[model samples]
Target: MTTSKQALPPVVSTATWQKELAALRIREKAVTRELDSVAAQRRRLPMTEMPDYVLEGEDGPVRLAEIFGEHPQLIVYNHMWHDGAEWQCPGCTGFTTQFTRLLGLEKFGARFVIVTQGPIDQALAYKRRVGNAMAWYSTANSSFGSDVGAPPDAGFAVNVFLRDGDTVYRTWHTDGRGTEQLSHLFGLIDVLPYGRQEVWQESPEGWPQAPAYSKWATSQEIAAAYGEDK
Candidate 1:
């Protein structure tokens, strides 16, 4: 059963809509340039030597440098995991589901993986439950998360590292919304009339809204909603 479509913006002639779209394009281009400038500055940031921390994966113990393999660049997603939670973080699971494959990153000489504070068996169990294909490791006894800016209580983070021979250096890191770059869901939502359907969005009056984080769901819940067996 399909739900009725929500009210839309006022209908206008093609020419009028084109004019409005063109106006918006100007600001979009400005944002594009600003992002380019910021990226350029980010590239020039100095690197810091990273500790050779060991993380636990399905195949027993592994060193941080080993994760990079033959690639010089490594991207790690620090997923949030409570000590005795029944499930992994919904936000992290959702974002990670967007990255079902990492073969494409190989072309750019980058390896991507996830690190969580949960135990190895628990992390692998959740991976199987969510059908995530990315390499996941446990930092339960390692300070790799905190060393890369994710405190024990922090939610999530994305850290980038560069390896020079056997030495690994931290190149960049971001947490919170900064990690949104890994997910395309928000980009699609931004184009919708209601824009994320979040209360904080600056939508027109009467537009649908919900409390922030209310839309989150576990991977199992999401799969079951879509009629996929888990």
Candidate 2:
């Protein structure tokens, strides 16, 4: 049996294309403004006092409060890691790749780090495998993961905290697709005609798409593709 290719969008004159683009731009601007408004509201949200959770780090056991260092804010990426899995979740790895270098975040008084439920040694090994320089810690014996809305098998999450002198507060937290904010790849793909090329996306007829998550590869798999060993 043979399969048929999907049809592409109709070709249009330059002037016609510009007209359609201009219409889309209007809605795009509206979206931008709305997003800005929502962000402003997010900034005004009241913070809740957080527990003094402890996690294992490369140096040794460290308190969540101490992770802030001299910074006034902290952003932790909760990564998914099962005990016996060969590698971490592809989506979590992809999200973390975008944060390999977070030196710029220091300028804004925020310290960024990754937290996982796996053993500290395993987490460190994976970090080294991916060539990530950012700090990583393991919440193996702590409720930090669940308290932050990232359970053992819950996948990915991004949580923000604020430090006030000797106290720490949970400022914001988001999980699931909200974690996409940490993904630069998806942001870049959104500008393309086919977007992420995921089956759930509403692409134009004839555009390419495959089942979502079907093409996701683990960090080790991705590195091996480039001749690097985990």
Predicted structure with the largest lDDT when compared to the true one: 1
Model 1 off-target regions past 4 Å?
1-5, 223-229
The TM-scores, one per candidate, come to 0.93, 0.91
Error of 2 at 88 (Å): 1.3
State each candidate's clash count. Answer: 0, 1
| Model 1 Cα lDDT, one tens digit per residue, 129-210 | 7767789999988988877776576778999999998899999989888977568888887877778888987888778889
**Runs of candidate 2 exceeding 4 Å displacement:** 1-6, 225-230
Worst 10 residues of 1 by lDDT: 221-230
- Cα-lDDT of candidate 2: 0.84
lDDT per residue as tens, model 2, 5-47? 7656778999999999999999999999998998999999999
lDDT of each: 0.84, 0.84
